[model samples]
Target chain A: MIPASFDYIAVKTVPEAVAELAKHGDESKLLAGGHSLIPLMKLRLSTPSFVVDIGRVKDLNYIRRTDGHIAFGALTTHHDIEFSDLVKEQLPLLASAASQIGDPQVRNRGTMGGAAAHADPSGDYPTCLLTLDAEFDVVGPNGRRVIKASDFFVGTFTSALQPDEVLTEIRVPAPPAGTRGTYLKFSRRSQDWAIVAVAAQATVKDRKFQEIRIGLTSMGGTPLRASAVEAALRGKSADADTIRKAAEKAAEGTDPPQDLNGSPDYRRHLATVLTRRALEQLTAGR
Target chain B: MRHRVAMTINGTQYEHEVEPRTLLVYYIREQAGLTGTHIGCDTSSCGACTVEMDGHSVKSCTVFAVQADGAQITTIEGLAVGSQLHPLQQAFWDEHGLQCGYCTPGMIMAAKQLLERNPKPTEQEIRLGIEGNLCRCTGYQNIVKAIETAARTMAAQAGKEVKAPAAVS
Candidate 1:
């Protein structure tokens, strides 16, 4: 399907991209790898007048450790994350999420920032990032500011980012020692998007749950952490009974929508099952 | 806007003016006239438009012609020498990997990427590598064999050793 005609401007610098977006407001959209936006444009869901291609801005494609956190340039491709030695070592949960994002071709072109900026509730990164307590570095005409993961996702396919702002970086706090986590997604096919996903990060000391973070994807209007379940599991011994009791609250307060993939009731059931499986895998040294 | 696109395809340089919206598959097939790069699904779902762009396999239909303006591309047509087919192409033919041949061009390109990355891939790795490229025929049994055969052939060729092709039973 041919996308609607639009002006194509390749910007070399962030300032140029910001200026173009600020001048055009809602009419302008920053183009990174175009995996998410182009598909939407082809479907006629997005018809911006100006597509400011910021892919050539080489400075925005980096993965670095800074300020006791890991900062990823929004332009970094999933391929980059899947292959990076640093990511594979220190951030295996994020790396595993990147590895499972899409088929090989989609992974080759899809960028992390593009996915995060699009803020699709069903996307894998948002749920994983929420569990990691990540922050997004937004650059706008006024200046730069950071938005926490909980506040970044406003609703389905929406974010707190203003029209004139571009998400420049994703900052994730370093995992605490003895931290182990896993992201479990259940899909009908290998390349199909997750029907339900659970990202669980846990710190176990003295065989007890020191800290637990549970994030749910495709559960509601946004990727959300299961605070109720976390609170239940906190300070409890890591065992089948405690894990099962905590995971029972996986979808206690969720308002999951019914779709062709599954019904809300089915998804609620899946959340419990997937959360239990994720916790089991993490506890088993997965 | 029209821009001069300079690219090297199959080690040959070509420069042409392409509309900003022209897709890379269109340029490869229409302008460069390499029809081997088929357009099965223009929406990038089918891997029939797969090609090696800048040493990595990508869906040409998903990338604009301008995005590849200064890149190197290798279509299925460039996978062989003057007369000899690439080992992958030969293995596919020998193993009857294709039925209708509609998805062969893409299957070969996707496998090329796999072999380039993992010269000796297991069956599971081969399946994972070409998972993006869909095939409606043969249920992927022969395609898996063809890739495994091609990997061995490629490894042998790299070591300058000639070996008889193994039969896939």
Candidate 2:
């Protein structure tokens, strides 16, 4: 399988990439890791006249600690996040989800910014980012702007990013002290996308839920927060019974797509079960 | 439009004028004359096209030739020194790791990365390490044993213990 012929533009810096995007507009597509866009191009699902290869922009491939958040360069590969000590210590949920995406070969090339920009409903990073309330730093012809996670994902396979904008960095606010998090993905196969997954990060104090945030994957057109579940569990006992009761509301407002992998009802059931397991893992031994 | 791409493959540098859409696997096989990297699934699901791109295993079928402009790639052909086989090749042969031998090159390449990161991996680790590479033959029993055998051989060659090398950036 080969993609349609297109002129390739290699950019060495973020300014150069932004300039190319401004020049080509919608006719061009920024190629970061090439893991997402290339596959679509091969299938003829996407045929861009120009491919702006940002892989040469080596500076946009870092993981750094900022003022109140950890900033990740848009080109930071999944493999780098999976193994980064800072990510493991600061945001273990992102690290855990990155480790389970596709496979080792895929992880080596897939980037967090690319995945978030692709905005697949089943993508691991979206759900984790939603739970973390990560902010995206985008550079465009008009200059730089930050988009909150809630506003970034518009729909399945869509994001709020304009065609002339490039996602430069992802800023994830550091979790509160003593906060523990876990990502539970239920897939038919190891490398397959999640059928239904859950991301939970919580802080428990005195055997009570201090703060908890839950995100569900493959439960809607876009990655969604399990608001009903979170509302039910806030300030509640961190016990198995309370978790089970709260988990029942996991799919309260979600409209999951029904496919061969599972029916909507089946997905709702999975959401409930996986939410319970994820919260239990987060609040274990509390 | 055609683009000029140059890279080091198996210790030899080759330059070619390839289309922007040409996959790295096709460039390696047709341009570089190295057919060891197989293409089982072109959609990047199968790791049969796996190759070492700058010291990391990547699906060659999914990587565009233009993306590997200045990379140092190591394919299955680059494994051995002279006529002697790499430890992984010898172990696979001894353990009967392959039946049809179609996925052998890719399996060995993927395992090369596995052992590079973790010299002594448990059986479960080996299975998870090669999760991207698929093998419909041998039931994966002997394949696990082959990786185990290769780890021990490489460890003994590097004195009593093998130290993980720094990853190439």
DockQ per model, Cα: 0.33, 0.70
B104, model 2: CA deviation in Å? 1.1
Residue B81 Cα positional deviation in candidate 2, in Å, after optimal superposition: 0.6
Check candidate 1 and list the clashing pairs: none
Top of the candidates by DockQ:
2
- Which regions of candidate 1 fall more than 4 Å away from where they truly are? B160-169
The structural similarity of chain B in model 2 to the true chain B, as TM-score, is 0.96
- Evaluated at residue A184, the lDDT of candidate 1 is 87
**lDDT (C-alpha, whole model) for all candidates:** 0.86, 0.92
In terms of lDDT, the poorest run of 10 residues in model 2 chain B is: B160-169
Over the stretch B77-164, how does candidate 2's per-residue lDDT look in tens digits? 9999999999999999999999998888989999999999889899999999999998867458989999999999999999965696
Task: Judging by lDDT against the true structure, name the best candidate.
Answer: 2
Query: How many Å off is the CA of A12 in candidate 2?
Result: 0.6
lDDT at position A208, candidate 1: 87
